[model samples]
Target: MTATHRTYPLDESVDAVIIGTGAGGSPLLWRLAQAGLHVVALEAGRAWSDPSADFATDEVAQSKLYWLDERLSGGDQPTAFGANNSGIGVGGSTLHYGAYVPRADPRDLRLHSLQGVAVDWPLDYADLTRYYQEVETFLGVSGPSPYPWDPARSYPLPPIALNTAAHIMRRGCDTLGIKTSPAPIAALSQPYLATGSEHRHPCVHRGYCHQGCRNGAKASMDVTYLPAAVAAGAEIRPQSFVTGIERDPQGRITAVLYDRNGITERQRCNAVFLCAGAIETPRQLLLWQAADSTLPLNDAVGRNFMAHVSTQVWATFPQPTYLYRGFPSTLITEDLMRPDDADFAGGYLIQSYGILPIMWAEQVARSRPLLGQSLVDYLMQYPHVSGLGINGETLPNADNRVTLSSEKDARGLPKPHITLTLGENEERIHLHADPTLRAILTAAGGADLWISRRTAHTIGTCRMGTHAKNSVVGPYGRSWDIPNLYIADNSVFPTSLAANPALTIMALALRTADHFLQQR
Candidate 1:
């Protein structure tokens, strides 16, 4: 069956109905469709638009992709490390991500077995290696497959040539007896394979990736997986917000009710896959539970929230580094990422590079005085500034979970009330990682280093486990109590990995898609 614009009645039924179209939903969309299973993916955000059609010209389009109101006030709350938020749109947060995708550390996969901290995943790194490779190939990843830095796999493409900032950082790491390599990125450096009839082009180094790459060089789901899924017969509905799930007495999902702005409609389906991400996914589950507590309820449905507690170390240099001339992240240091660290309890992966003067100036404007010559001098020498961000693992805490607030959005649904704070272990990870990052900056002739310890990479609300009592989803990411109800988002993560969650989320989605395909 070929995909066509679907009407509200949905004259035909689908084998699987996926909600959310970002990291987790994208790959699953393609897998289920390719497996010949009827799939319909619902996206709350609008489809990607040309730069001209975007409303707020600057960084607003990137940040507000998910239809977040410019007046939205709750996203900038304080956290265990720093300020963090999420984007909502047709591609979900992937449209706004930094495009730096690294595989989950093998050590990360064995966290439970090694430390006895969280419950062990029913699956491990080896089980997902093949799927990771498939995802890497699909995304056209570029980087070295060295022993210490990468776990092991042939990169689909060569790493991007290092810029001056990257070269300087690499030299500093070499001097410190630490390994620094080109971070595996999803951006096209040289060229990419032309899959199907789509013509993939190489990156032009516009440095405007987060603004929804106009050149189609970035491997966002919009350009990669979603298009593949569409070609394979997957129906995608944008701007459709799923408000409720209608389940039968047998605990199987029957229909998904949604609203487009204000009008309401429903569609019947055999299975429902919730990939709305950590905060929204758990919030939806909790909402469903509140509506009917007897529906295969798990106390852990909204528990065990976790993410990388990140901190940024900014510095002023003597010369212009052209930091924003290319991709924001091209280099990294894993020296401080380890299970056992004395100074910091949590592990951090240090990255160098990001945004430009206008953005950094805005950030500094919020603080550090915006008055006379001081601010003017700061803006004048902005190109000479460089920074290192510490992306580190965080411990899961039941208390640091997402809950529905008394307040509601425009749709009258409860707003996301996140009660999260950094755990002791996470604080330790940053403490250990920052100084090593600072040393690298110092060695590179950096001064006036400013350290910021906050992050927005949220994860692990509806985690997977062997037993229904312990987790919401099962080994294959299906809801343990309700076979038809599946979770394909970051909510399935038990522990935050040492690296970014986006790549691992895609791998999990691939695994889930394979599971569903095998069932057919």
Candidate 2:
């Protein structure tokens, strides 16, 4: 399937224009095109024309898949941008994700009402149940059935086979009396025949999920939703960098202005969907602010930024584990994921993980200046190393935000400045979880433990809420000031769930697409 590409006459119009082709925009595009709406999706990076040729297992070459825009990390707990969190190209971050797709715990939606801390989502888990089921089935998600948190349905496919890393983690979890389950991932365990003649092959278990999947096994947008969208007649324009949104006197979005190569073009549309993720979505909003300072868009457009606080706990086993043989993550323990009686406001999930040698070396280097033989000594024990990572929920703080910087990019737009700091609550979760994770590893005959702090899955930049002044978009992802404008990305997440966010992001996209169709 192919999409019609519009070149520089600068005057093509569509019923709707989507700003990104990741998990968010791809599903929305497919749904809208299926509903007979003319949709154009703008992707900032080049398409993965030949995955086998373009993608490699090497770390240095694979770094090209990330979003390398010049972003300044501010405040105390500055995040490692590009390689760690964001992605580039046609599939967006899904191109390099581990494909972990756990659904958000029901408590994640009622954080305000349950714990009396952050703002609650305008909608709850009950509201998103059907959409979640739809996305899970569409992606052929594989996991243990009747998950303890949400026991409504079984997975579309059986779980991925557990690797040695998973076995090791399970042993430790059993000793600690923690309940463990197969990691729910979007990667198919068996061949899946999707809607409209699209078939996805099962995962080969190459353990390079972060790199582009060469076999079309992982459910990245490039292999899944984007192709379906193109087959349904949605125009996908690659290398099309959206600069700003054009609004009329009444502040209704009318057209999207973007630059392809060196040529500027305008695509007129009745409605616009901002699916540019948390970072670029807010950056685009700030760019629109520069265009019309008097417009009464929501003041919280770029506030309340939340990225899950992640920390890696590494240990050395007595023998070689060959941790990088299968999927990078396989076993997960969510025992600590709910704030039942915890001192922290939110909780976290512990999952088995395997890192490439280059990533491990870089992480070790960042923690302490390990040069000379010391670095070689650390690298020598690679075969005996295994690790577990914590995906802890982070509270949204207005100070931790995405703001426009004075520094400009090649497009002559101000670079997005990201200021993120760990609050007391998040720090408490880390302090508590780290020791628990270490004890588990120790019980599994592990030694030489090390913990490194990191951040994963950025969310909540363009928060959704019930009120107009407090949020950028409403419950349905429709803008309060501009009725036709909508957001279909992680940017609209109200709270960062302890679970990996890829599944929830796609679910929200599906819900927003349905709402747009209903309105039409």
Best by TM-score: 2
User: Which stretches of model 1 miss by more than 4 angstroms?
Assistant: 1-11, 49-57, 66-77, 80-85, 194-197, 339-346, 362-376
Residue 10 miss distance in model 1 (angstroms): 1.5
The sequence of per-residue lDDT tens digits that candidate 2 reaches over residues 243-312 is 7777787778788889999888889988999999999998888888787786566778888888888988
Output the worst ten-in-a-row residue range by lDDT, candidate 1.
Answer: 69-78
CA-lDDT, candidates in order = 0.75, 0.86
My TM-score estimates for the predictions, one after another, are 0.92, 0.97
Q: What is the lDDT of candidate 1?
A: 0.75
Instruction: Specify the highest-lDDT model's number.
Output: 2
- Candidate 2 deviant stretches above 4 angstroms: 1-12, 339-341
Error of 2 at 309 (Å): 1.3
